[model samples]
Target: MAGSNFVSEIFLFPLSGKIAPILAMATEIKAEPAMVLAGVLLSLVAIYIASKAGGEFFNWLGFPPVLGELVGGVVIGISALNLVIFPENGVDSSASIIVKMLELTAGLAPDAAEVTFQAQSEVLEVLAEIGVIILLFEIGLESNIKDLMQVGVQSLVVATVGVTLPFVAGTAGMMGIFHVSAVPAIFAGAALTATSIGITSRVLTEINRLNTKEGQIILGAAVIDDVMGIIILAVVASLAKTGEVDIINAVYLIVSASVFLVGAVLLGRFFNDTFIFFAEKFKTRGRAVIPALTIALFMSYVGAAIHLEAILGAFAAGLVLDNLHETEVGRELEKLILPISDVLVPIFFVTVGAKTNLGVLNPAVPANREGLVIAIFLIVVAIVGKVACGFSVFGLGNVNRLAIGVGMVPRGEVGLVFAAVGSASGALSPALDVAIILMVIITTFLAPPLLRVVFGEGEPEAEEVPETSG
Candidate 1:
């Protein structure tokens, strides 16, 4: 009878666990048909609350709301708001449950557990990549080509200095101290090449510098920096995968990226002209704006096909549309894209936090300890490296050197993306992965307060533009 009871209990496990958790946790679940619906609902509420809280926090700190959004995600993932909980059993809980359900229903095993786990992980990874692609598309829609161009030369110099110094410092520090492999050290250095423009943009805006010459220069430089970083990532990925760094292929990628930039500009000019001509002639109600979005998506697709980052393509598309005669159309596209970003972007950040395992820092794990030491060395390199770039701001007379340095500090989405890719690629050990994530968080979190101190202010008031009409 006891044996029979034990079997019965085993049989009852699924039903009890399911219903009990629905009542008790009221948060955790598989992304099933019903749970997906719940996730959507929860995501909306989470975004709204996060946005508001993020805004207030940034306002207080004189930084951008994006920093707040990112911090808010970190807080939620680390806190007990219980909105998007991981599987109760473990990382593989969802897969395990599904397999058990299948066993109970079919009374026979179909495949190895390892195979099923691999398949599920692959699917999750693909979904995450798609989320990132869409994010790049949204970023493209927000970019303004005219603004980028006006700030281009100075920004390029700033970005170049910013990228080079960090890469050298990070690589040297990792290779010399950690005695890590050259390839991994290069990857580590590559990871440091990213600058979080969102944070810098916010800081400049807060300090009433966004429209200033320096602010525009910073924004332009950041956009260029992002493009350069993507190209480097593609090259590194190729090198890692093939174990051979082809000089010709690397040069081809750089040349191809440059060609694309030029082509995008010319194409954008032609499209804007054609779009304006048609819109003026047809005067169609809502049909006027769809073309811009269609073009943006198409360009993004082309960018991916050409071995370039999709965000670069999207930014190109935005630049092409910028200074177009279709201001109304641009505004409409912005409105549409903003809501989509609010929903999807948070998923990316939340997933990022969820993947970060802080326990990797425990000294009990020898490898983890090695990673922690490497992380400390890398962080110091990362800080000192960018600080060194402040001296490279040439031609701008009496510029606030401290502000430039502070602006270069935040690593933002670019750094996280690099770390995520490294982690996914198996190039970064778990501990090293956590360290990179921590670095990204620290750099982003420190920007606002650092900027406030350097620039002096509680949100600098906007300066008046002199009247142009005579």
Candidate 2:
């Protein structure tokens, strides 16, 4: 009864009043700012421990470390340990071990627990958003525009086929067979379009096939897939936000994103010298990276200002900076950016895992049965649609069409980005979100071994190398 009253107070009153039950008989209280900060600090500890442990464990097991981070998040999140939780729907501070620890040790009054939890969760979410922006920026820096252009027609065909098949099939199936609403179906379809360049590239490099013909096509096609996936992501996210599509708005986003990408590339050629000169002039410690980040942030702002996703801007900035990446300054910039990525990027992945409720997959729950069926359907579509891209390769004799198709299979971190955005927008029901997440996990797990089998390679040589950061 008391817990119910507390929940009512939280819902009925403003934030300031929500913390008052202990301080006064009436519902009015001033929260300690220190308590909120304390909560954030504690949450970070949990996030980092989970991320590192999960990553190292997965890396040891010959899987992508990011997957381990995801599973780690699952272990610590609402679905498991409850070390890190959000105040979504029926969830409250009572379910959070972190909040409980705070209450026990930090003199955090019971009445203020909810407010502190809300504040901390908001901070973590901001960190996760920043993490993804940096992630796209890093992806841009690594992609070779010249090389991607060289692969040209074959890659373009593969990327187009890869994106189109999954999107058309997934969206149509969701609406026609499952009777899902259009926007959610579109978001789900968009999620299917992502081909994780990071995971694919790592597998190729490991098997000494990175320089092979099939590998080049796969890498180039994956880059193109990333770009297409981004555009699709921007479009679907917009659709999900509005809950109804306006043709004008959708077209505007598509045009604006294209112009923004092309314009940045063109404009970058003229400004490259000026950028270097300005960057070199700085005597400060963060000279190289600071200017680069400024560009990324400015572009991100422009993307948001134009009602496109901010990630589009950051990605464009990375492409603009790609030319400079080979220089001494660029090497330094890469070294610097990596450590930052190591710290923040996992937050994004883990948070996505944490938000996921695997409970929805339980067959014992009557409502979940539909979600399970949809998940199976999505898994099949995710595989078949991407594998079909291999058969689309034309005019190349003895090209391993199977390898190229399997290479495009893993959704990796890119798929997670779609899932996160969709879930955040309230566009996906819990069941549907979990379904998408399951598809991502299955695809990510299957692709490496499947790639090895198709390429006829033995186990990868044991060597330490930096994993791709997409």
Q: How close is every model to the real structure, measured as TM-score?
A: 0.73, 0.78
Instruction: For residues 257-300, write the lDDT of model 1, one tens digit per residue.
Output: 78887898878768778766665566565455456657766887
Give one digit per residue, the lDDT tens place, for model 2 in 1-470. 43233323322333343234234532465556798789888888999999999988977876657667778888999789999887652488889999999999998999878767776776787788788788767776765555445556888899999999999999999999999999999999999999977667656755666546677688778867876886677667656765544455446556766787679878877656767888788888988888888888899889766655576677678778887865777887888988887788788778867876668667898767777888898989999999999889898676788888999999976897788778877899977887898788788768877887788745243321223343
**Could you tell me which 10 consecutive residues in candidate 1 have the lowest summed lDDT?**
461-470
Residue pairs of candidate 1 with colliding backbone atoms: none
Clashing pairs in 2: none
**Model 2 worst lDDT run, 10 consecutive residues:** 3-12
Winning candidate number (TM-score): 2
Angstrom error of the Cα, residue 136, model 1: value is: 6.8
Give candidate 2's root-mean-square deviation (CA, Å).
8.0
